[model samples]
Target: MSFKNLPLLGTAEIIGALNLSPKQTAAAANLAHRVTQSAWRRRPPHKSGQTYEEFAAAVSACAWLTMFEVGALLILGRHHDARILTEASRSVHQAAHTGRRR
Candidate 1:
């Protein structure tokens, strides 16, 4: 089968769509994962402790990684590593496509 149309590359093609070497892509992916994790872990501003402006200011004042960008990076890595998607098929049957002509 030709890999010309597997459609694995994610929506964020801004980073040249898998143009980088595998090692670089892998490192980017790892960084993306860490960023995602941190984003998920960050606590939302408390309901009573801070006003919207204060919360916004606090967040803006801190050095923060962009989760959206990191997510894109992860997608790039996933494009190269089909196994990452394939592994999901074991539990999520819908994720698998055998590419059979019916």
Candidate 2:
């Protein structure tokens, strides 16, 4: 179960050594998939002159804004308050685009 052993083990072997329950394993897998997908999707263009740190910051900001929008939409439901979510999403989108163009 040591970090040093991780590199030598197959995925199943690692999972077994960790003794994760089925639900825990599934959740871990799902989280790993999400992280992988996000990394792939947000990877900066090669030779774009942007540092990895800058790209990561932008990606994190976008993800946070997206989650905020979703939460707002859910909380507002289908009521008139939904307009707030729409406006917030629009503002964030506009700001992101504006920042990128500078």
Best by lDDT: 2
Misplaced by over 4 Å in model 1 are 1-7, 11-18, 45-102
TM-score of each: 0.31, 0.35
Query: Which pairs of residues have clashing backbones in candidate 1?
Result: none
Alpha-carbon local distance difference test for all models: 0.40, 0.47
Worst 10 residues of 1 by lDDT: 60-69
Residue 34: error of model 2 in Å?
Answer: 0.7
Residue 9 error, candidate 2, Å: 6.7
Pairs that collide in candidate 2 are: none
TM-score of predicted model 1?
0.31
RMSD of each: 16.1, 12.2
lDDT of 2 at 96: 89
Per-residue CA lDDT of model 2 for 1-102, tens digit only, reads 112111223445535654656655454444433443466566657825665445444544344333333333343343354466557767988998999999
